[model samples]
Target: MFRFLRSLVLPEAACEEANNSSRYENLFKKLDLNEDGRVDIAELHAGLKALGIPLGKDAEEKIFKTGDSNKDGQLDFEEFMQYLKDHEKKMKLAFKSLDKNNDGKIEASEIVQSLKILGINISEQQAEKILKSIDADGTMSVDWNEWRDHFLFNPATDIEEIIRYWKHSTVLDIGDSLTIPDEFTEEEKKSGQWWRQLLSGGVAGAVSRTGTAPLDRLKVMMQVHSSKSNKMNISSGLKQMVKEGGVRSLWRGNGVNVIKIAPETAIKFWAYEQYKKIFANEDGKIGTIERFVSGSLAGATAQTSIYPMEVLKTRLAVGKTGQYSGMFDCAKKIFKREGLKAFYKGYVPNILGIIPYAGIDLAVYEALKTAWLDHYASDSANPGVFVLLGCGTVSSTCGQLASYPLALIRTRMQAQALLEGAPQLNMVGLFQRIIANEGILGLYRGIGPNFMKVLPAVSISYVVYEKMKQNLGLA
Candidate 1:
């Protein structure tokens, strides 16, 4: 009431203070494109676009109506202030609504009920996970202070900083599995700080791959031998591998796997950035379709550049110890015995597989993130760390599932023996042969071990990359 009275009176002190706040003054000037010091509907849309709020016409009309009081069809300085105040009040009311029974604290059930009001149906466990994040006391509840501190004290409310952050990525960026969370200055990048970032990513990748090497080798073994001779369970696969060479055999191909991480990451990340620029609008906004296209192309480029290493890796994974001593030995033998075509035996299937994998992974991640934001973003600007991990895991698993058969085929074609009179198989021929010989299930050979590694691989890779960035003072 007092605010209303003050606005009516148009106090000189408050007006002067607001005018002096430079940040708001600049925003108002930008939005007042006509130099009339008032923001019209078109100008408001322009400003919102610049601020990275990608709302449709209906949402724009709803937002415009809130600030254009007295049906002026435009927002003056006082009206803009009123809009900000009203938004703040709405946030407060939202918090209070969650803190039902006037308890000044929000519990998991309250959160669940609040989301239900928004037509968001989530399990109690999911609700509790959300609550526990903001529940600073570990009491499974958040008091008023916790709520205010967690939600209201955002640096992004400053508008300028928020615009910068939003410009980075409106939706989450699905980086290569080895991505580090860091930003570099132009000068730092010119000085090759990116090399350090790439090295950090390589180190993280090596650690993760080495840590999960056994499961990976197991996956390869299953993919190659699951349907041939005797069915290879994880136990029998391990026993066969150990019997052939020893525990060291499990890491046979890991050298190439670890080595390829650096270039693949560097190329994919660099190509993705370039491709995003090619796809971006004048305002630098990329739609989901553009993202998928750019991501697919980037992935294809990287994979093509390093595919020979992929052939080498598969060969080593299945090679008996005496067959080839090391990476160079394996490459030399494949080139000499089978010719250069051996390196690209399954190139067609590999390319087809990667496009869908990259597209589906990015699409699923964006969908999940958008859903979470639409339904549960009232109390926070960013989703929790666990939410990110869960989204990545599920999205990656879905992508892998979609592309697994092609992947299995590619690996088989890579590791196939070049024997006299053996049939040369293209993708269709291989698919027909596998189905005819081993049934359709043969195409899904190693999916069990592949899936077993997905969650842990994503979790460990992300956690380690984040930690490395933090340690390097880049996060």
Candidate 2:
């Protein structure tokens, strides 16, 4: 009769479990360590310890006093469950608050601010801890789905899908060499991803640039240092480097850059090829509009991955007074002081210019190459190094002319970030300052040396890349 009455008042599941060999009652009795018919602070501490919960004495006291009604200093099963639900609710609220920008994603910046609010001032170690906490997907950025599924939705379900998406979105892909194969399928003949062909043409640029990162680093250091000291010419800069820092200093940061360059090139080039292929017909030919689209996307892809490395290389190459030791040290300090996103400084214009730069570069290169082939007899072999050099030289001149303005902006933005009180220069601010201080011509300040370096670099690079491609049957 008592069991029936209890079942009528309490939940069926709870009541059934309670009377099942008195196990539930035994648990409750164990919790009520003093047999006082309620859980007091001391009894709650003992119960929590037995359950292996790490509730410190203060926490145990707080929970016991809060949950215990009528000064009983103890909790029944219902009280225990209610307390758990409350704790879960508080945790859910806290997690939701961390999702700043309300974009269903929480970035590291948001995590840092949220930590400050929680009275947990983060050091490098603490920041790393918080980053580990929020970056559940493990790709760095904390997206909304990751946050929701991790803390709010399903804590136990495998989060591979969320992480996979994060990886896909964040890290850039350098497409396959044959992605915009010389031929296309019948279905592709209809659906127009032809722009992809042009974009994929960036593969060549990526390949070419990837090989010359050492020289590129030298060039950046030279430009940054020279421009600041009014030593504007490339020859002058090279001379100064040999005179002051020695030739070895010219190749500083080359080691770390090697690993980055190839992948960066592959991604940009693949994207350009894909874009171009989309716009072109089966013949792999494109018009002006297709050219623009392909070039833009290709430039953007290459710049994004390489930007951080570019920044590091610049710092390393320009280390005249021991500001930094090496690329890794520079990267570490930047990440610790400013965080990871600083690596992508000046990403905007750099990416924006990539398309036109790539388009014009590839277009001119192919056009010149074709013209040279025409110069040869029909059955004659294709152009040799001199002809290849001429074609590459022309292509680079055109690309540099088109890209110099944006390049100037990018350099200023990257360099200024290293300055003490240098007003944080955005693309707009840089553009405006360049125009105001140096006039429109100032935008092309580095164009002369840029052209000089680009010509030889492209000449050598294309020859190597084409030869490699041909030898490998990738062409």
Candidate 3:
């Protein structure tokens, strides 16, 4: 872990290779688009675009002022390099603080407590930001290499600083105030069309489902297998499944899971984006509170649409008595026998828990990313493996904390079908059933293992996905 963290704080030979290449010198050549040795607003924005960083008007002015050491409203090679180096230093500091435990690494639990102590309360957007940053492999954690590449060494820090510097300059230019259009232009709206949103959502869902199926299956087994019964642990359950059937038994209801994942992921990302846009400033910047609101909204929306399917998936995965044939069969049977209300058996818990789950997931993602970009100004990719692992661990821990209760409730509701003439357990009914039979503690069953299972799954998934996206230039 310390090695991983170390990587995030340093840079590779190739990354700094740009220095030998006189990358900044080349950038100045490009920015002098008119060969006039001076940059106007258009020229500055074009220069930013050349570097793959688009800036709004306010951000543009700040960059021009900061990089234009001559006060001539233009950037020279020397000035730009200076700006890049300063930006890199700040990013290093943020990542250093993120690795606050001094254990040479970061974990989800560590991040959560750290944020709480830092008085940096998180919201969903912030969580997503953190997750997306550290989740280089998209498994949601920073492996050593990923932590090094992205979190420890990012190009965006320089890019962002340039923009912020310009924004401040622009504000000073226009009556000491920064102005942004209240709504997206027609072109911007077109860029964010519904189809694109749908595609992103679907992809996220598929990714998450594909990554989490094995763990999800194990979790359900742990939940449904009666403690008094012979099956008391993951190993016993695995042994029983393999003994009775093949290894395929472990994937029992994965079919339903795959189908459900696309919509689930789609809804989650879509809702999150919309919520973030709503609560953020016109310029699309967000604070901790805004991030939380967006994340919670996204979580709630996704859970509401897909939770019933989650229940069905769990039912089909468990109860090997040949009760259900497939996802559709399970759904059909549930609807026919228990009525539509049965689909939402754990709606209350599921919906409420989703708020925190989504919120923390997205917020942590953003925070980690911001921290990464701050530290590594030379590399375009985020912190490498170690950073990714740290971010992932932190994100999953928070998600588990906020969602555990709901998970337990949902499990009980779904498990009702495992018994003969499963009870008509709604949210209240399930609560009563658990409390009456096993006392309040029953609601927290398997929490320890659940955390262990979910945190790693989430961390790894985010980290892996991020790495893939960055390689594709998506991040």
Candidate 4:
């Protein structure tokens, strides 16, 4: 808070002495750029900027609000000093909490243990990453001076506030649906915001899937039926579907697709948290590798649990009109004709796809976000909605590109039994056959339609999610 401001303003005025009025007066005069008796937000911003501290508009406003004791939109010297004293006390308490051993310094172990108490487990290495940011010197630890200096401009009032500031990210549902669900802060969970956010995301996904139902259906049809003998491009594919089943048939499988969002998201989120804990290193930290593993496992766990719905969706999408009445009817027919095992025909390829999809999606997203921050953070810490969506779309497309072959194979296997004269091939056999019969490009049969849906799906999802978040009081 303002405590760090005093240190930056008057470096030699650290002592709490009543006779230090001259030093305080000098500091106040320096900040009062207009030669007025008070300092306003503009002056404060200019002062911080002069010191090479680039703070966001929100942070600057927050400081003004906190220090303007009389709500006069400015801080007189007395008000400024009072705010600094109060902030100093809070900062000291926070530092003490992290300095668990009372050694007057915050180390990696201390950060790890402290965060663990708050249900945030981190390995010592990850803790070191945090320390390195705040530890001005190469000592790899934070003393009172370094801590105060690092947070001088940050308006976080407590340790939890500081952690929250660092941990929060703008999570956008712009990528492959199979990617891991967004994480919620402990505060969000306790305050019931987590469910609201999840609900918003769920509604967004449902609408997105519905809006792109025709394209999704076409993608499935091409993946299962397209061959060297039967070429299927987007224009021809759409015409065929309309001719065969009429316009309404394009939404055949959309019911189950929308219905699975809630449970799949819930299971993925729960499994992700559990897997992260399991894969954490001995120091209680999860690194890049651990996160990738956890996310992939979480996706697989969710996909496995709800895989029957997937098979049903593919069946319904490829089914002609009157083939199945609804989701229940589709399930009944699949169960009656092919037995329980039929629901998991393409399980291997589906699960295998999760690894490449989740890994590449996460890695690319992180890389893009990191690069964006490195380049643009000096101008603004918050990467606006457009930037986030762009990164997510690019990362998702990359992931889809890498995993589309497996996905196509899985779809073919799922529908093989239903297609007339189709061979019931296992995962590997299907791959071999596709390559041999249709050539290497055959593995990417439905990718055109799949890629075509990415932009529209993401745009619809983001717009709907934003509207829903506002309605839910989450924005």
Candidate 5:
């Protein structure tokens, strides 16, 4: 009778044990590519890639180092279980230490104190900014729900069961890394998550584009109206826009800009996945170079499919009050006057720009991420959110710098009309004219707003993406 009463109240342990059994079985099958019940670094990477989690080489090596307690250079079943249990305990303890009052939420002051405890000193303002992204309730504090949603949403492991692992022990690791292995353990695949990555990326793109629509429109305006005759600068242009219409005018092209996200992300991902397989060898994994090639081609294909939407977006964004009222209105008129081919006016330059932009962006981001892990991240597994944001902003800025001139030219061609008397300018002709008339500086028109949009845009997108993954249980 006593045991039955206890079991009724404390059923979570048995539930977690069952979950652990299944989770371990799935992970062992997937990570042990050779079916040897042990996971090597290469197989671990391959498995992670399949699960849609990306990681740096240095981070992967570190996980291996930490997990391989016996120093065998591989992780057996027992070793993996121990690693999970250890990390889960650390996470829960971290949360508990942050919640000094023993209340469910970690308040603004508590977060500040907790960061100091971890030796991560930041101003109160910076602390608030970082916490704002994870504060779901708008109560200015992070509750257990918010905390779990933000950091404990790994699909590879049953973080719910991991919570049980934590409840059994209140102790934690203060100096260890919290970076979870981002591999697709066999356990995650059973839930039919093959399509989760593409959907998540699509959602991220939509959120990012919509958030930055005003800046994107400003870019178009600066691109098309940077001449002395127009008397247009960023300040004057924004003032003119608000004068013509209210602040709502800023989002004119956002509708079509948002709609293309799904198909584009889906196609790009599908193409990229296929290309990865094609490039893979007997090991069924491809290197970064092969990944880059696959991504570039996939981007081009997706861009071509929705090229018309981009043209329409540009037109609506730059249109006068009477010219275009909405996305369909602009599209119908452009189709009627300029016909279908006009939608692809700057197709070549746009396509060419993708090569340098993506190449530089990926190369720089990966390089910086690995460097950060190698240098400053020796003690911890996770590099933290701030580091990821910094790397993204820096890499995006570099990419835009390399490809800005080409981007400027493409915008001009798209905004140009297809009238018979207008001079037809190929890319070379356009480059020559801009250099001769406006000098090389003309090619970098409107770069200020573009750069301004990068950091916040990337930061918001990443935060939202992680939250969504957790909320959707796809993390």
Candidate 6:
């Protein structure tokens, strides 16, 4: 994480007082591109790119605004020198804060202790990972020079800012509700940006679900009603839905589906944080296995809390226009006729599905992002919008493929009572029944529409999220 900062600063050691002026002059000459003695925005951008420091537009604008003290929209050598000097001072202060023992070196233990005070508990090993990023000589520690060199050109003024820089991974909502929630820093939480981000995500999710409600409804219908006796392709399935309940009916269950996003996200994030703490080893270490377990447990916790809504969504989607008045009516009818247990009809399979869905989603997304960075990103690791969307879509689809059987079973169980004269079955029984009656392919019913909705859903969610973030001052 901190290693990425290395590219932002001039390669020369800025902390060295000796020959400092000459070093700055040389760097300025390099950035002046045409020897005009001034570094304009274009020159600065190209200079940074040449130096392998690819900053975002906002970051570049901020730099120009701050460093161009003359209000000329450009930087002269003197202004550039002063800017580096001030940046170094800020970096020095940040380094001192981490060197708690006043030993002039930031060790792994120091890193752990400092972060622990900030409510971010990490093991010595995790601290080592952080140190490795900035520890240029593999001394397992960072001295003032190393720290200054690492962050001299970085815009971060404090530890939180550094973390924010490192936390710059793209968070795409690919319309799969089962994917793990994004993590937030303590600073983000305290400043209330975490909630804003969540709100942005929620708004994006609502719009996406609503936009694709018809496809979603058709998926549920196929999952519940498709069998050996009935075949449902995308075209015929959509026609049947329109014929059965008119156009507006396609959004039958979308309201509850959208409504549940807040609580589910809130619970999942809170539970994930708590579970991470609990899963941390004696040294506060959390490895991949621990993280996976924490995420899985947190997901299960969230699903358990808001699971009845899942049933409601399924029921409403599969219901005819006049089958029930609304969400409340559907809930009342289910409780009255089928008892409270009916609300948890497919609880087992739903909970079980979280493991594969979350695991594979995380794995595939990381793999894809890493592959892209390794092959395509020579100067910057940020995988622009399309790359991120492509990775998210592909990863989410893989996860869906892995867990669709369980999802289909869960949907069938949720809608079992609605199937006149059909027998109710437990998770395993339903699996057996589907395999016996409809063949192996029965497990993947409605997968076509489920997949069909991914690209557009992701695109809409991403665009809406970016817009919401901009409006919320998060962009």
| Per-residue lDDT of model 1, residues 137-227, tens digit only | 5687867545543432121222222212211221112222311123333434664646666665667667778777888888888887777
The best candidate by lDDT is 6
Q: Which candidate is the best by TM-score?
A: 6
- Over 4 Å off, model 6: 1-15, 18-150, 153-171, 281-285
**Worst 10-residue lDDT window, candidate 5:** 170-179
- For TM-score, candidate 5 versus 6, the one ahead is 6
lDDT of 5 at 87: 55
Q: For every model shown, what is its TM-score relative to the native structure?
A: 0.64, 0.47, 0.54, 0.73, 0.61, 0.75
**lDDT of candidate 2 over 1-475, digit per residue (tens):** 0112122222332322434224335445656777766666677667646643335443455565555656565677667556644644654455567767776555667765664443223333333433454453367665543443233211112222111111101011121111112223332234332334323334445554454544565556544544433755666666766776676766666555555645655575567668877887674555445645665566566666577987786566566646677777899888998778788887787766665566676667667765555455232222455665566566656866787677767776777766667688789987896677667776766555454556555544455555544443334
Ranking 3 against 6 by lDDT, winner: 6
* Order of quality (TM-score): 6, 4, 1, 5, 3, 2
Clashes of each: 0, 47, 97, 4, 3, 0
lDDT of 6: 0.79
Q: Which stretches of candidate 3 lie over 4 Å from their true place?
A: 1-212, 228-231, 280-286, 355-385, 439-441, 452-467, 470-475
Please list the C-alpha lDDT of all candidates, in the order they appear.
Answer: 0.67, 0.53, 0.55, 0.78, 0.63, 0.79
Worst 10 residues of 2 by lDDT: 164-173
| lDDT of each residue in 1-475, candidate 4, tens digit only | 2334444565654444534457557667877889879999899888777766767665777677778879999999998877766776788899998999999899999998997665455567657767766665569888886776567557767777776533323344532556755666564576687888888888888888899999999999999888889998899999999999889888889898888887888898899899989987785666556666777788889899989989999999998888888889988988898899999989998888888887787778767865776555532334556776787788889989999999998889899988898778888888999889999999999888888899999889899988888887665
Q: Which of 4 and 6 is ahead in lDDT? A: 6
Candidate 3 lDDT, 1-475, residue by residue in tens: 1123223322242253435226445545666779876556687677556544465454455456556677866666677668656755766555555566665555555555446443345343344445454554455444434444342223334223212211101000000001111122233244453344344334444555555555566667766554433335666666776776567777787677667655655566567668767886765566556655665666567767877877787787775746677778888888998789778776677666656665665566557755665555332333454565555456656666666767777777777766778665677777787678767666666555455555545444455554544443334
RMSD, every candidate, angstroms? 14.2, 24.4, 14.6, 6.8, 17.0, 6.7
Candidate 5 per-residue lDDT over residues 155-235, each given as its tens digit: 223322222211111011011000111123233345444456445545765777778888888888888778655657778
